[model samples]
Target: MAEMILTRELFRHMCEEQEKLDTHIYRTRETKAPSLKSLDIAYTNEANEAIKELQKDWKWWTLKERNRERFIKEVADCFHFVASMANQTRTVGYCYAAIDHEYQKVSRISRECYPHEDIFYKAVKGTVQESIASLIAISEALGATTDEIMTAFEDSLKKNYGRMATGY
Candidate 1:
């Protein structure tokens, strides 16, 4: 049998876990509101927080430095929000389109705007999938890896489940 990069079953498991965590986190005393705007805002905030972790090492003079572990965990937080953004299970293809989007965003060139465009893809993906792929791109750019993300995400999910049990 050929080796699989990421199977649909694994993606489905992640989605199910995130849905449970989102349910607990989004519930309120009065009501629950999961508008796209809200999720988008949350994603941005998390991404910003992740950057702040890197900012420490970005400073030239200050002795403060980036904590690699914490930084990746912060990035993982962004992944958590992306996973919660209206859970769609229609996509599990390679991230060619998604990777291209990330590349163009940083490279300033895209097939959409130009015929002879730079591109590469191992799989197809959707909107949310693209967002996830972009995060992977960002992570790799910052010297992180998918393994770290997987560990951090699982840790976060476990922590959230603990919060759920605590009536939080």
Candidate 2:
């Protein structure tokens, strides 16, 4: 519970980078409208994928080992959708514009949020910030250090670029 090392500045930069991936995603593949609701559902689905990765160890009867790397990758994917969600709002402005007041709220909620401690199917009344909090909760639950999460994000971006190259 120490202060999160992932500062808002870094978070914004990460979002910008994710925007590149999202651009490729739209160009190389069909995508839902860049609407908040669409992004919210997409982000929630990615969160569930992260949970699926975490559940690899849930079945005591199985000998499967949870892959930290894959779980972190899924968490990173959550951010990808988050950044897209941000773009739909002029207030958040994908963290490009000054959101000092808004970010204060987002930071607090993101840090304190564990509203859904179980499998998250959908957000009842989700916003971009709430979705971000959920993503943070998943990262914390999986014990993924901020550094690891950032690295996974970078890797995901690279993979997205590769996917674009191959028409994925």
Candidate 3:
């Protein structure tokens, strides 16, 4: 299959849609406030959830059976929150650029490396945090293809657009 590409326009729209969904849901709940917490807290929590999904104490052979779908969903959730955080901070462009750049680096490494080698760890380059590097690595280790991630993002954007304006 041809590689899936996420353009800046799509990223912006996804973030906008997610924000709208958040607003609508919060408004409909009546008691829940609309203001999102600090991005640091949100990102950390989402990343932790993704990590937990991957860290299920199953045998290596059973890992796919036990955690694949949940892990993918958690990764998607991370993307959603990350996009929202970027939008809130007016840094969506930077966020997209960074992700795209890192993704290209990973792709190049994957193309050049042996399958059994630790491509993820090897893909890490200057200035990238250990945690972020791990995330990029784990994403590949889990077989989360770029196309799959892009599809999840697009689906999320559509879902968010379907929500009521006040989140109801």
Candidate 4:
């Protein structure tokens, strides 16, 4: 397998594009009010829904037997909301920077000993692993290749850029 190369510039561009699409879509539908605040609420709601889908408690029996598609879609919705939020704050770069920092920490730890002495380091390491697990789950559910996700992300960027400022 080849190494994946993701850059902040690409991520920022993608988020900007997604934001444009979000604005246009909301305006066209007029079903819900749209704003950065609304996007934040939507992001939280989607995250809650994703968590519910992953639940293995009593509620699990009530969910669809095969929820892979729904899970994938819900995750995608979360991403859309995140993109909009990041674009509004002009903080997509910060988000990518944090991801890269965490990635390096994980790589370093894998090559060395775990930081048993540092609670913060251990917590960061665990967070990195958990984040990877979530990504793996999404990829598995969607049956998506890395290339496919990349292509879809790029396509989204293009479509978003072509959309009207209001998401029409």
The 0-to-1 C-alpha lDDT of every candidate, in the order given, reads: 0.52, 0.60, 0.55, 0.50
Model 2: per-residue lDDT, tens digit, 1-168?
334434566568776786666666776677744777777788777766765665544444666676767777887887777666665563334443333333343445435653333223222134545445544554555566768878888888888788788876
| Models ranked on lDDT | 2, 3, 1, 4
TM-scores, each model vs. reference: 0.62, 0.66, 0.57, 0.50
Q: Which scores greater on TM-score, model 1 or model 4?
A: 1
lDDT (Cα, tens digit) per residue for candidate 3, span 1-168: 112244566567667766776666667666453234655455556556655564433224445433666655655666676666666667878877776665565554444552323443332223322234345545665576666766776675566555544352
Rank by TM-score, descending?
2, 1, 3, 4
Q: Residues 18-120, candidate 4, lDDT per residue (tens digit)?
A: 8667676667666543577777666666655654554442143565453544554555555566667666777887766655565454434432432222322
Error of 2 at 47 (Å): 0.6
Candidate 4 to truth, TM: 0.50
Model 1 / residue 10 / CA error / Å: 5.7
Pairs with backbone N, CA or C atoms under 3 Å apart (clashes), candidate 1: 94-123, 94-124, 95-123
Q: Which should have the higher TM-score, number 2 or number 3?
A: 2
